[model samples]
Target: MDIPVRAHIERLLDAHASDGLSEAVEQAFRAVPRHLFIPPVALACRDDGPQIIDRDADPDAWWDAVYSRASIVTQLDDGATDIRAGSGDYTCSSSAPSTVADLLQRLELAPGHRVLEIGTGTGWTAALLSHLVGAANVTSVEVDPVLGAQAASNLAASGHAPYLVVGDGALGCPERAPYDRVHVTCGIRRVPYAWIEQSRPGAVIVLPYCPGFGTDHALRLVVTPDGMAYGRFPGFASYMTMRAQRPQRDQPARTDADKHHLTTRVDPRTIGHAPAGADLAIAALTGLDSLGQADQDEDGPRYRLWVSDPAVPRSWAVAVWRPGQDEYQIYQVGDRPVWEEVVAAYFRWVGWGEPGRDRFGMTVHADGQEVWLDTPDQVIGSEARSAC
Candidate 1:
């Protein structure tokens, strides 16, 4: 690990080595050179470590960005617009090293395993997978023609030749069916039948599933012998939605109610119940398929979340961030009164814990995102339908 490339991956591998995924991740990291994957962009290495990048700043900031924890939005709307101008609705990216590590941990890939990666952004993940199980054992798909070609070059430069395809990922590549594992780099509102169909019996499929709401939760499922996959939320993570699957949500409705008030605009009838704290609010909203954040705003940190859903709106619960700063209030309203749903869902999630996101399983049918939780084999709407 002497060269810039070696050092970049060495640091990444070190972070996860203690976590049992060290070997698979190390092989993958050692196999691919991240600098080669990020084309034309000036290479910047940070002394603090972890090759995360912030592509928004000048040359001086690029080094810090690449090593930081935040994801550098690679393609906005699948390379449709300028991210610098704030319209690059994220499509693909070189995800932060830790996130990639977490996803790989969820994947649980073993030696000699075959894996299919949905997005080849920077070809980093695919290269890592290829390294873990040999390049011949990996197949990667990218929707954008340009990105696909670039990834091919990136993979080639990294000394691995993963079969890269320029096509839709939602329709997983059939030629490479019966894969031992399937992992998606992009966020998906709908889980594709292709994944379940192509996965070999007992194969594990890990992906971020956005059930047509404001927040997308990571789903790590295993293909059962019967062609069905059941798993639970590994954790909360978000990605730029796949190009064809971006939510077509209307702007959130604005209520005349005061931002710092108890009165909600939605009918009280909709309020089955609410909880006593922000944690419960966050959990319930997330249980409603909405992800919520509950934290004390200490030190006045600025946090921004990107969203496009009317149902799973976004808001802030502001509080003092200093010593003896205990007063807290909800400032929810505007186009998206996100916190409203948080309070609304807290009551529901407080109860859903009876079973849990894990207890809720997926039974793929020919036409539905069929899922039921301790309940029966109830059919559910596709991610798109749920948004509507």
Candidate 2:
């Protein structure tokens, strides 16, 4: 006998009932057998941490993983690498059940509303949408052909026949125009205007808004008759980026022979101590990426905050704070003093009363998107050209 998957679903629903999981979503969870969509071997289960489950190697572990409240990495390196090998960039996944439930509740789906799903990794979400609406009303698009085919097989096995499209999800499926709701599973640095254009005037568009920073939050936008979609971010979520908008890894340039050095009394740790939405604000204000590392120096253990400009190669800066030091040392290279910009952004966030993610909103227009703190008229930053 195996562990009863429905039992696990009940437990999951109970755990998240107060966290916005709805009765309709609970019914869908009980209806879908997640194990059917997952491959038999080498499942990546993120319980306390990441654990690999090989069915042949350990059947019990595989079953537990299949039912666990964790996101399973279905494909890595865009399906180029074998799962048995055990290590690569996660390209696609079946999202954690709790995450799926929350997003579904936020969507506010009706009985016959048409939904357009971006990033049909395992078709689990599509199946759930089909359960809410009808299969004929769901259009799921996957960028990878292999994943698309696999998802199609999984959906068919589960007795669902949603319209599955194999193409660039960024472009969306226009033939099935004017979706009632647009739900994107993939994280994107920039929200594509095409998603808004394909939605009905009152349609809701939900997606993970990742500005290539510390964390991502779900952005819920409502399309308007004026050809714009605008709304606030409810909470945090981190998803893999759409392939087309994925950022290339740019290593810091070699030490500049003429590097500039300075010192600040504003302890480097202060910059690391971020308020609610400070990281997102900093990323938007300076257009830079940041990381913090703890290491030992000649004197003692030190904390270093690194800031780099991903778009401009060779631009980087580091601020180091050591024990008993009143001031932090800063070293900067390239044309931009990234550390200074980060510090300035931190002050700006502080000056704004340290607002949370809920206070932040996004507006997607025909030309581009704008991020605002409290209102659209007070735009913090705008990206004229989206990578997508």
Best of the candidates, lDDT: 2
Which one wins on TM-score? 2
How many residue pairs clash in all the candidates, one count each?
Answer: 14, 0
Q: lDDT per residue, candidate 2, 282-362, as tens digits?
A: 877887877787888777798988788778757877889888888888988877878878888888988999888788888
- Runs in model 1 with CA error above 4 Å? 15-20, 42-64, 83-87, 212-215, 249-262, 265-345, 352-361, 370-388
- Write down the lDDT that model 1 would get: 0.60
Cα RMSD for candidate 1? 6.8
Cα displacement (angstroms), candidate 2, residue 35, comes to 1.7
Tens digit of per-residue lDDT, candidate 1, span 289-367: 3323333455653222221233444333321122332333334444455545544554554565534344444555345
TM for candidate 1 is 0.70
Which lDDT values do the candidates have, in the order given? 0.60, 0.83
